[model samples]
Target chain A: MNEQSITLKKKPNLGRRIGDEIKRNFVLYLMAIPVIVYFVVFVYLPMYGLIIAFKDYRPFNRMGQGGIWGSPWADYYGFGNFVKFFQSPLFWSVIKNTIYISLLGTCFSFPAPIIFALMLNEIKNLKYKKIIQTITYLPHFISMVVICSMIIRFFQTEGILTKLITLLGGEKQNYMINEDAYRPIFVGSGIWQGVGWGSIIYISALSSIDQELYEAAVIDGAGKWKQLVHITIPGILSTIVILLIMNIGSILSVGYEKTILLQNDKTASVARVISSYTYDLSFGEGNSDFAYSSAIGIFQSVVNIIFLTIANTISKKVTDSGLF
Target chain B: MVYKPSIGEKVFNLFNILFMALMIFICFYPFWYCVTCSLSKQADTASLMLLPNGFTLATYKDVLAREAIQKGYLVTIFVVVVGTIINLIMTTIAAFLLTRKNFAIRGFLTWMMLFTMYFGGGMIPTYIVYTQILGLEGSILVLLIPGCISVYNMIVMRTNFNGIPTSLEESVKVDGGNDMHVLWHIIIPLSKAVISVMVLFYGVGHWNSWFNASLYLQGTEIQPLQLRLREILILGQTAAEGDAGDVSTMAENIKYATIIVATLPILLVYPVIQKYFVKGVMIGAVKG
Candidate 1:
């Protein structure tokens, strides 16, 4: 009955071992039931519905009997939806728009946070640092809806942003209504919203660097800038790489909600990305092509998976740290 | 601490301080503008300005009196409070159970949860599931049920639970207490920081969520604050009745008022829990 006997005793078979585990942890399994049910219903069941992409789906088709739950994927329209998407005139623009916005966002947003963290680390006064940090981080906690609202309020025709542009000898149109201005506005607002909060991890990483490294550098007559370039960046390099990989992983999956709120007919040409395209196609005027839009969604998810895996692998090779 | 003055270092320090102050100004200026715009006289608010001119509470009074804004506030408060509670309970129970060493098929269960994180059925397919299968579309339950237990939060809570020493639970067991007693008496008490973090995350998520409601629900009555704010601010709808120019100016100011009213609830409480969120991120970054 003691520890020696428990270790010295013959091991049980796999089935017996599992049975014993269940018997011993019945309460835990009972607790897990609801979570298991939630995933099954919400997550797994919907994943199964992704197959509607391959079928000729109609909305009011028999719910479970002859529609999605049936063997609809074996028909002639197996790849018709995908073919139609590939052949569509909107295809190239959607791809270009999504990538353009995402890459622009990543280019600025990914580095802005790192630089913000580095700058914050340089501050000597704790009160000033705390004040600056709180002010910067406040915008992050503000809802995206509020953030978008603020953006629109600033960019209206007679709004402050427009007035400033007119004063500076630029055109006086609302930036939101300008098609060419879409990427800059979207990416700029994205950085303004996320840069402060994104710096959280890097700041946390900065705190973990061994103090002795800085002390040694100081004794060696290295300037603060040199010490920063050497000790600080290297200390946070792995975090940067890991975060970069994640940022790249989400390149295709950048937010659609913000675009949905911001995109009007004037800017839709530049602002219409893959997710929004899918949303529009599914619910827009005469857009009952559920199957077709579902195909687009599948295209996005596949590309996202590929991008994530590639970035993760590159991260593992370069830094020995990856998201996996 | 006693060192000779270096002019370059002093210059660098001055520059850093100025740049940081600029950063703070950039982040905070928009909110400041929103407040000042809401309070400024409608005509004065039309021009580009830093500070409020001819200040009045008319816009705030006007926006708040609207039935739409009131409904939005009520729905948001209900969803945030109720959804966060449901989220915390479900997440804690799931995390606690998953962290148990004796739980069978643990790896499979973990994989099931994590799989959803990487790949998901996109909007149309998920919309079908919600509308056709679950009958959640157009219902308030769409907001409440689908995201009752966020997978990311579950992972964080589970990681936190795993960090706790098993001896605490064992001691409760030794005292002839059941798993529920151990969870209530030990795990819940010990995981307060992480629990609070999860609460804050879920609260903010629910409060700011307009996308799902916008997609699912058809009516404005059950919509949350963010949705109403979205319509007023982004959709460029006028909230007041008047002549074209007069109402448009009032609408712009009223939109700013709505922004302040919508954001102030969360903004007011952020400072107190700021440290907890930073701590949460630090802990999550270590393992996640």
Candidate 2:
């Protein structure tokens, strides 16, 4: 009887247990059905549409003129659009502009939050800290459209901000018209808008730092600065590294919408990244080149993926923290 | 908590206080200016800045009177409520399934969700699928269905589920309870904190999202509050040709008021659900 039971138990091991688990969690599986269907229909199915990137995709004769699958000369056009993109006079400039803006934005915006969080953590008066945090967080929820509009208004000629700058002995310049000022305006505004809200995560990480460590540092006659440097900084190092890695991964995406919104005739040259270019080509009077635009979008996404992977690998090697 | 500061520390504290105060003012000033501008007299408002010389609720009344804005508000509210409910249900079930030690395909299912984060068919393709393939364009289903299960949120919910002690599941199994019974009776009750976090995430996402609406409902009256506000604020400013009384001035107060209106619900709900958001983001950031 014991031998028979042992053989039966072995039969119901791992794989069989999984099967039974699936059966038991039938209700849960039912709940997941809609989501599964969603991705399969919207995401997986459309990946096939990427073939249009290779083809001379026409809206009217989608199926006969060259379906994504059976298009004539579509395969030959392989890398044709890519070659055109690379050979275009704007290509190198596009890459340069994207990297420059993203890096500048990240460099300014990322550290602002950490500094804000540290300063907030140092505050003894709870009410004042709360007020500061509340005010700071409010800007984040404002619609990007509204934010962009406000930026336009505040930087325009005779605006209050301009008046203030003039009073401070600076010439009342149309800062928005200058290409050199674009990076500063974008990065500065991003940091100002996001620092408080972004700092909330770091503040949480700070709170999680063991209270005993600070006490121990105090007993060792460590000053407030020393405690913050040795105890607090070390405590939140991993969160910092993880966030840094994630930020580095998307270094090419300069958020085209805001740039497009903020763009004018003068700033367009400096502001136009792959995203804005693709958008202009697809929708704007430039080309209305949908297939070309899609190809560019793919190219941008591929570059981002590569950057992210490299960043992740580097983080794993150096800091032992990665988003894998 | 009643720690005293040294003289040097006090000076530093004072500096910090001033800096924080300055930061707060810098942040709040734009909204304040916008409010002032909107309320000011139209032509007179062109050069006006800082505080409003003449405060009026005229712009607020005008915005509220617009049928488009009103409809947008209703649509946004409906989408948020329904979308969050769907998110909570789907995520809760998935989280419940993940907690089962005997669940064999758990890792596979988890990775399936995560795959979406790295790779997605870009917007155009996704739009084609929704419009041509799914035939759900201009429908309410478009808003709730396309982004129903965010992989990041799913992973967070699953991680929270994993933190629930394994004994909770085993004890229920010991009583011969089936999976559904245990999920409803035990897991649902226990996972309230994470559920609320997921709700806030979904709610805020739905409230803020206008891109999808702009894409899918091209000609329909399916404008959500954000979309309507966006059309006025973004599209208004960029292509300001039809009107001439300083488009910026016209938008000033109404823009701030609309922003306040759009964001106030979440702000009100936030404090009640603040602890969950704090805990969720903290844990998610660390684990992530």
Candidate 3:
């Protein structure tokens, strides 16, 4: 009798327990169906379509049905497109431009917010700070199209910025078409749009630093500069490190939207990055090499993942904090 | 104890104030210039730098009178309204379900959603699926359907929902309330701040989106305002572009006017919603 009771007292198997849970929460499960279906169709199904990166995908084949499944394996055992991309002269220039632009952005745009937040924190008057923040944050809400339009207008041959340059003894020309001006313009505009908004996180971090520490430092004969160097910097160091890590991880993902809108025929050589190049191959006028573009896309995604992982690892080693 | 600043500190403070004033001018002047130029007449626009050279409402009237601008506004408004509603509903349901600790498969479902944030089918493959296989090529549904729920926003909402006391949900459950009732009464009421933030984020996103529309609906009549702005502002395809008449000289004024028209709503509503936006950033920073 005891043995029989022990056998009956055993819990149900994992599958049976799950089945019972599902039955018990059937309403919740029913509600989840739409989200599941939406993800599967819109997100996961497209992931399956990523396999065309390896295939010679032809959307409008004359001789056969045109689809991912209908495509054949690429040359060199499915490495043909990537190999072609690597071999092309456009590859190095594209990579160089992407890195150049991103590095310039990191050098300037990354630090702008940190400095702005630090300076803003120095202002004792509340109303002045509020007004400054409000005006500065407005550009972030403006549409990229509008911002780019403003940029184009400002840099036109007869534009305000051009006139200012002429006043400063520079030649009168459309600076937007100048290759040398592209990186500065891109990075400068980015800082203009993002600095105020990005500073919010750091400002919050700064505010959260314990006031008691500053009081203690003041009592200990530390000057304002010393207090800032020792107390304030260390307090926000972790926030700074984390944001930097994230920025480094996404170093290669300079979005093509602004680049596409900003680039003209003259500056295309400097402006074309990995993403815009992929866009051009796939959708630019008279070009529809799906397989090639997909290969490039996959390449970019993989490199980005690698960068993220490396950054995370380094951050963990140095700062003892990481995204994961 | 009283504290006094050194002479160096006083000079630094003065310099900082001047620097801040310069920054404010730099930030405000661009939009101000746009406004002044938009309000300026055609001949005055060339000399229109500091202030309104010659004020006129004709530019606004002309830009607004264009059929394309009117249609663009209608399409954008439709997408922003309908898309945000769909975004809220889908995000709310997802967040509610995922926050239910007692719900089985919550972990699995959360992971499934979170994984997409890291890895996504890059643009071309997604385009193929969206355009060829799914047949959303020329449809406005292409914009509204595919981006129904931003996973990051859903995660933020889920975080907010998790903060609501479980006892409240349990009380509703004891009253024979189902998941929907718990969401309606307990979760939604408690999470209004986050929901408003979500609405702002999603609404602005829909309003500013042009790349996807440009890709899928290139030649479609239902192009959004930003895309239309791009055509006129960037590609220099104003209604006056083809004509060699005097109206062509007003192209710059028209472009400036179009920008103001497209951006006015956001600027008008910004101050009221600014606090919520800052709050949203704070909440996101907590997770980060």
Candidate No. with top TM-score: 3
> Lowest summed-lDDT stretch of 10 residues in model 3 chain A?
A58-67
DockQ of 1: 0.68
TM-score of each: 0.93, 0.88, 0.95
**Candidate 2 lDDT by residue in tens digits, A84-195:** 7878999999999999988886778989999999999988788888778777887776667667767766665555666666777877766666688787888888897899
TM-score of 2: 0.88
Docking band of candidate 2: acceptable
- Let me know the TM-score candidate 3 reaches against the reference structure: 0.95
Task: Please state the error at residue B117 of candidate 3 in Å.
Answer: 0.9
**Interface RMSD, Å, model 2:** 2.9
Q: Please give the range of 10 consecutive residues that has the lowest summed lDDT in model 2 chain A.
A: A66-75
Worst 10 residues of 2 chain B by lDDT: B40-49
lDDT, model 1, position B141: 85
- Comparing 1 and 2 by lDDT, which wins? 1
TM-score of chain B of each: 0.91, 0.85, 0.93
For candidate 3, the per-residue lDDT at A159 reads 84
Clash pairs, model 2 backbone: B38-B253
DockQ of each: 0.68, 0.46, 0.65
